[model samples]
Target: MNSILRITVCAYLLSGCTFANSEAMPYKSWRLGFSAPNYMEVWIESADVVDIKEQVYPRAMSGTAAIQTPLNNTGDPRGWPEKPGIGKGKNVTGADLPKKIYVRWQSLVEPQTYQMVINVPESTRAIMRKEEKAFCAFDGKWITDYRNALVINLAPGGMAKIWVMGSCLPAIEVTKVKAVVDPRGPYEGKSGGKYDKLSDQSKAYVEKFGVPYDSWK
Candidate 1:
């Protein structure tokens, strides 16, 4: 092969190409945290291709395993089995970030689907660039578990507060978006037993499985 052709092949391989000519970037797996008066459908845009959590639910501010389940990187999706070819994930830099995360909800009286987009903050992406800097305190020492996190905190009157769950870098509010409230009103529910309200089967899984840091559980 010519010198230029050989160099081109090397560059492609180094870029973390999975499918020929396809662009796959490495993303610090981040999970979705849901907190609202009523249950709403939520998903990360393009989550499947990026190895992110798609189907998910975890209390946003419980401060427990609700958002702290996977404290160890040893079980991370990209390297969980401790075996090669099992975790097929690319390692892209921060330049490939800014996943277009979207949230939508509708319940009870407020049957109209309310939608909004929460863009990833440059601050969080900056942290992902430096894995050493992103961290979370578990037991005693710090760990880089919750690096690429995204949060949704909904309130009455169609208000939403999005946050970057950077843990050690300290969680930061990324943006806030408000939708027009329906004439009926927001969905009303009790927070005291949010988990208890779930079906018996779901609650059982919650007790055993924790929503991981990298992908949405």
Candidate 2:
């Protein structure tokens, strides 16, 4: 090939490699896990988002009293499952990992959805990439050996945390959201339109665990 043609071919090959790296996550499975004191739901807000659900274990089964599973489009009440998780898990492909997620849950007030950014610092990702089969300093109960994962954790009252396998990053309290309203559930109390406030009962739970994994608000 001529010098110009050789340069063109090398550039094309380099671009292809970059595309592959972005499309495939460095993990067996990437999970979208959320929890709360009550019911909640999480969905990918980004278009062309990757979903490799078949790669995740313990998929949702019909008629299982477990009530919460990845297939439920939800999170069961009272927090993360006794198992690894009760939310969505997939072997994402076709695009770069997303930087945000959507969380929906009903509190004393009607359910609202928040579109919040997921901030995973490079240092955190590096720790997860080299992580051994150990525990997450954040999600203590889960003893999973995740080498590298993109796990989103949505706490109640718009508080968000994330799990990158072995690391659970700090909380990102979300004050602004779309379609928020007043509390009117059976546990009805005045929210004054600020959805970030916890209900009377849920407040107690917060002190015990820094996790909002809450009424799923």
Runs in model 1 lying further than 4 Å from the true structure? 1-28, 37-96, 107-112, 121-124, 132-137, 144-146, 167-169, 180-217
Candidate 2 yields a Cα-based lDDT of 0.35
Quote model 1's TM-score: 0.40
lDDT of 2 by residue, 77-190 (tens): 454332333334444433234332322233322244333323334444345445355545656655545444444444445544444443343222222233222234211233
After best superposition, candidate 2 residue 90: deviation in angstroms?
Answer: 2.0
Candidate of highest TM-score: 1
Spell out the clash pairs found in candidate 2.
36-213, 36-214, 37-214, 52-90, 52-91, 109-183
Encode model 1's per-residue lDDT on 47-105: one tens digit a residue: 11121211212111222112111322222221112111111112222224443343434
Off by over 4 Å in 2: 1-29, 34-37, 41-86, 95-109, 131-145, 166-217
Counted clashes in each candidate structure: 3, 6
